[model samples]
Target chain A: MDAPTDQAPALVLGLDVGGTSTRALVATADGVRVGAGRAAGGNPTGLGPARAAAAQADAVGQALSGLDPAAVRYVVLGLAGGAALPSGEDMPAGEAFARVWERAGLSCPVEYQGDALIAFVAGTDRPEGSLLLSGTGAVAIAVKDRAMAARSDGHGWLLGDRGSGFWLGRQAVVAAMAELDGEGPPTVLTGLVIESLSLGGAVPGTESASVFPEGAAPVPASPASSASASPAGPIAAPIAARDLVTAVMSQPPPNLARLAPLLATACAAGDRVAEGIADRAAAYLAATLSAVRGPAAATPIVLAGSILTNPTPVAARVRTALAERWPDAVVTPALDGAAAAVWLALDRFGRPPSPAVRERLFSVSTAS
Target chain B: MDAPTDQAPALVLGLDVGGTSTRALVATADGVRVGAGRAAGGNPTGLGPARAAAAQADAVGQALSGLDPAAVRYVVLGLAGGAALPSGEDMPAGEAFARVWERAGLSCPVEYQGDALIAFVAGTDRPEGSLLLSGTGAVAIAVKDRAMAARSDGHGWLLGDRGSGFWLGRQAVVAAMAELDGEGPPTVLTGLVIESLSLGGAVPGTESASVFPEGAAPVPASPASSASASPAGPIAAPIAARDLVTAVMSQPPPNLARLAPLLATACAAGDRVAEGIADRAAAYLAATLSAVRGPAAATPIVLAGSILTNPTPVAARVRTALAERWPDAVVTPALDGAAAAVWLALDRFGRPPSPAVRERLFSVSTAS
Candidate 1:
């Protein structure tokens, strides 16, 4: 291939491909951002490589709309679940990345990185630290020299992921079911569940039935409508419990994570059961983080994901627990993933971005 | 409907309808078995009323073949999860039962009983007792005067059923995933899981990658063929772990129960992890049983369902644990459910059968 030698490249491409969404950015060698684009999630593990590659390409194509491909030099992409791929020539969405760049008409050596390293780099420039993330799922990773050294408890929903949004949501549903069945003590979660699932009205034809091994009785529910008014635990019409169960069993298990938002509302209303769940979630999260962290606690522990990033009782409790356990650890939020990815692309070329350039990218990403 | 009134009717219909299968029995008032039939499960809660009614009709029709429906003096239909239905004309698969009788051209009143009571009646002529059942699911029921007085933890898969087959199977899968991931201690469970799920081979194209919130690394596994032969924890080719996860995720959650049979083989081979799981399962089952039992220990507790009735480590442990907790509690096996339903029908007519008749029905049922 014939090429003109430019002393300084005008643009470098950086991408943060996540399970829910994919983002792309193009910036100058000196880290002055020029373009950004977004697309649907491109998690290769969840949504195979072809679909994932398509998303990555769409985002990259948009970001490079007005920019010339020949002007782009260094390129780097950070992908979630990148470590789960096969090695070397097939590393970290290897073929998917190839398709993305080829379709975008860009020719440059692309540095593919895993989410852990990218997230670590996103929060701090430090080479060694740890990361604890609690989103729909949860995981703890120890990073050393810009690479994932060790990790724990990201085993998916069927295996582990304790203290995750899915876990909390499951707890909420289980509690509501138990309370309405008279198999558990009263809890505000039951009322919230009735209200949330819209189980307040009569079920169409019959009361819901759950399987039992012996001496079964159809569930006990009066013909009366639901009385889910009080947060202190109103005795709901058992019919509501039946409806609640039907609604839950009808969907995929991961959808339970959607119920996680109910906890915040319950916690605000002083629901003890909600409070208890939050405490347990914090404990579980702390334990998972510690499993990968070992004895050293004096590193920057970047907290990421909605559960840790948002303002909830779970978040507050987790922060407190982490502080108590790792007194010397500096807890930081992962601010700007795509921008941080750009910083890594710059670092890969032996040219670190100035503090001002890093700030500029970080500020813009958060603002957006 | 026109019917011949035979003095001292010669036959009665009894059925045990479950989620997996529906068993129907036709016997003389003196307890001589005339006919028997079984068909696909007719659980209205799971299969819906119309389809469930169809299964019941099929089984009843088969049992009534070559027999005059006019000779039937009493009928009892026992259904699992019968308590969860609406009352009156809709009582206990009400329409489903009506369809069965109408289709059969039988005018006799069809009595509907719950599985708990039928299972309890299967083992005893007495009225007050308790039942502990562990099949695909688990439940505890207290029977007083031949009715369910109190119950606990039969809340289905999502909420509870702690020591049920579903629970044990889930635990086995989770433990296996953990061992292979190196997040937990190495156990024979990993090899068993690999063998059971047919995951010993490579996943078609992927080294299965699970979702993680942050600091993730794709799983670590080698390209070598699976070495799942060693029972005491072989470091399997990571590719096998990838396949194991993919297999587990592909099926419906309850299908995990299919893997439960693997535990018996592992326990026999002296796998510590397998033994631990069985013990824990037994403990949970016992606790659930104890919850509804209160302080009374002299009441007979009929241990019904596959996990308790079958000869496995879980069963043995549960028997021993129950004995230790309630020395005076007579633990009996529920011999034949359909036969028991017939007996209950006889009891309802104020005609407690002779010991010879009970023995004959019970023996005939076991033989079938």
Candidate 2:
């Protein structure tokens, strides 16, 4: 092992590389940590993993400043895209830390693995734990006796995600549009989507530069003139990440546990046509799990991600479904995923920290 | 025999009822002479079978007014939503006509049959011909001799249509929206959809009551007012019948055989997305046909509806698939559906007319 550059015994650094967000946590080894410090940003893999990993390093390094650099002993980096060689061999994750460590003049030996692996570790700390992550992107990972197994349901949001925040958000948008056209079952999200887009501007013609920039260049001659011609909606304008959240939130039924209230208020008063999005969503997640782990892989499946943490009814439905599938497996509630990242990293290094250290590292109070 | 309502040669009247339009035609006893008349408004059950029959009677009455009422011996009405009875029994479709004819103030003998029955008759005139209809709605009808022997599918637009004009058009809209959100493969249809909506005068703030009455209610007061303030795009609206024609016209490749030049131009510019959509549509239609009548059904299948008449690439693809599947069965070019309706109606009374009357009645110039 490389010489432990950081001497800190209390803090264990956890890195979670997701398709959508890359989160880092510094916490005490024992699972009950508040938060030493946290760093959040877009997934480096999506932004081009190499550059994103470098950016992540900068962010992580900035958060670690003024801390006991020598005290830090173990590092756990879990990647969204598993670090598997093209020929299926194991390889180090997309780590820019070596370069970062050289620049910072600090050396901490970092163990690299897939994000699913650490999520499994963080959720249950058992080899047989199953971890599902539904953040900016979606993925599920399972580990048993050090034998790692995984499956990618879709190519993220572009191709498919089946059941994730982005998937639900996208489906909400589709349901909204379909409802607008009087095609599919009604959804409350239509109003929300319409509102979110209007914040940007009118759609289509208004986003000439952003949408069909190459095609619109010759038509306008002036950049200012081109912008003015576009429509006033997110379709025409650049959409923010928060808008996607809003879109997903506004689609669930009221009784649903995931995020149904958003869909309920609209549907109950009778203006909302949000379909049974959560029901379908729960089914999708269950189906994906069953497909991979033998319809009866009934390990304690840990639900992690904003979707699982949804205050609405989706969680309840998911719990109910899992109960039917894995009656014996316990359904654990979701904590802050970033915090899970931290706890996972600590557990990864083999020295689970004390309770006090965990309390000092986790800052869940400010998370939401 | 019942007294002939018209003094023209003994003939039967066939009517193909649709959501937006209703077409009627006259067919002679030989089962070959078919011609189209006017398109009326309203559906069978929606208007009540009584009212629907009256509308059909009026359309047929005016079209054959010059001929002797006594010459028209039997009237066969192939009505929509008349496939199976409420109890799932195969009942004579005459209930629809009797209800309509009684309301029309005439007691002329009328036989009611499912639209698929006539479509099958128009396809082969044999007892067991397979007829596939790909209109705004879709269904398959197979007949053995005069008996309606079998039928495969008809799920309507909401639950499923599998392959139909409505299905294809709706798919086009979805693909366009997906491409807009960068969620799916891109297609030239995005610009087309946008342009089509713009042409429909879709603007922000003022919800068009004429378009969507359900959502036309005043935008509700909500914290997310910003998202709902904007009006939906016209393209995002439920596809209209005319749009279906445009969507159909925009498919088929190589020589641009079926689609408009603009669509062809976009596809030629290396638009794999649009190509994928077109290819999928072709596959869907072929699959639907196979599902209804097995790949090796004994009857020579008739590809009815507008999708077949035009020399579009999608249609060609459907033909190719059918040929590949059957190898031995004959796939006839689509006959004008309304014309087939006319022939079916004439044949129902066992009063087939000469080919001259068929040509004149089915002439496109006589549509108005």
Candidate 3:
């Protein structure tokens, strides 16, 4: 992006604001990069508008600092919440971003879209398609004429999000606990969950073995919880059910996402319990996609979010499920949301880039 | 009770400590109540040991205030946690209650029992039977010779307690939210859930109705969300999903229990959706009971917890299900936990009260 700004060509600014972080890209209509910057999460829905605004401004200002603000012809904003991004009063894409631009010395018409659209464009320059995402949460979107036509299953963790990272992680904990309590089938997941949480051998059983209320006898100790281990790291003692519960409950509910990766690891090693969880996650995601995409969907479908972006078991299973439903559908993996946002800006300005250009933009992508 | 201490006879003390409150009863060998007292909750598993001990001490001191310490020859402590009451060091029933008795100037051998046993005794004098309890939480206990022989599903709100107040209330919210999102069937639960949470047309959608991430078009405004009514109370425009989520997430998760009553009211008024929820709750409870009881469980079946003690549809349904499973089994509602503890105290001392005495003790019961 060091080509002299004195002769800088007309460029557009694209911002991908999400719960985890904010990224911005400034590039010319011809697909040559001009500037880039990033900051912490600026998702107005997840974080408040004020903080989200500050993060957006910080990233956008940095992206434009290396070039003339006047040359930044247009701006496009894509929020992670996709069509569900809160707006009327909360959309940083509108009021908050308006203030963000005014403070950063830029004046240009802006185009706003949900993260799903950006993710969709990142995979292809399609004007109509669908997007399926599963990160801390999960959602499916039906894009028509370059905008969301319909959506499904983004109701969030408590009531919905049946196939999300949070959902998978929660299942892992439930399975492990059930096993430890002698009420479920035994699996290596019991060991993995405890080890991942650093919850096994070292911690004293928080609940007393002689607790009277559990009755005259505690649950017949399962094989997995025979005795407490020494303070040796990794050589976990049979994890106590109480310890597992206290660990899971000590944090914000959504942090369970951190444990989702463990399921893939466990399932890969042929653990039936973990495999069952992975199967359910895949089915749940496919079901959500089915709700918005009618039986004979032939449009392009984009997959984004941490779980789907990586070459994980969950992702492979989901792809297989999707293929079964609509084998001919174009299934694309989303790449470079910031770059996709720029392409969208170009499209809004009636200068949509070619397929090669889309690939080039993705080439400048940073790893998630 | 103010019976004369100068002519005191052999008496026993019983304490029922729960998450909500602690109660104590002191009675003579012949079924005459000599003293009674109550204090805030002293369940060690729910509240920390120190606080639970203090509450238990407060209740016991009051119960024994007018009685001679020498006459208080035996003591019994039953905790609401039932068999799951953490013991080794945490059971307030053990070290904590021992300390409580010492502070109250009474020296007597004590018997510790789970609340299920107390509830079972509250219903009948049977030492071997079964108990099903559902309050803020739920559990099924199999009692043998006045001690917990086996237990099922006291895993608490996060993983178990499927038929509890918290579980039922959480279902109401989930159903209402699903309806509001237009993803599920319609029901009065939608209105009741909103009104009960005070979440409705009053909220400014909290989310910008124009939020871009939910895509370009918002959910085609359902018939329910057409207009925003003015500040006039109760004439709600329509409840917004965002407002409902915000309200539910803003409190301790268990507070959802507050919404359980609305389901009963809705079902009474012939709301199929509410009735469906009630049916599932009953089925879940019966399933839990089935897991612990044999096919022809002939022992007395004691029903405890606020839901079963009342005449709600859920309670009625559960009783019918139990009746179907075991035609001749005795099903009784738990009477008084403190009195039951007192009876158990006498029984532990080989002085089990007669049926007439048990009835007199139940007569002195207080409302929840």
Give model 2's TM-score versus the native structure.
0.43
Q: Score the docking of each candidate (DockQ).
A: 0.21, 0.02, 0.17
The docking category that best describes candidate 1 is: incorrect
Scanning candidate 3 chain B in windows of ten residues, the lowest lDDT window is: B211-220
In model 2, which regions exceed 4 Å deviation?
Answer: A1-368, B1-11, B25-39, B45-54, B64-71, B81-99, B103-106, B199-270, B351-368
Better lDDT candidate (1, 2): 1
User: Can you write out model 1's per-residue Cα lDDT over B36-146, one digit (the tens) per residue?
Assistant: 888888888768888889888898888887788877767888887622423224364576668678778788777777687788899787789899988777788888988
lDDT tens per residue, model 2, A226-305: 22433454454444322333343334311112322344334343332333666777787776566445556667787766
Worst 10 residues of 2 chain A by lDDT: A82-91
lDDT of 2 at A298: 60
Candidate 3, residues A291-350, lDDT tens digits: the string is: 788888798989998899888779999999999998989998988999988988888776
Determine the iRMS, in angstroms, of model 2.
17.3
Q: What's the lDDT for all of these models?
A: 0.73, 0.50, 0.75
Candidate 3 accuracy as lDDT: 0.75
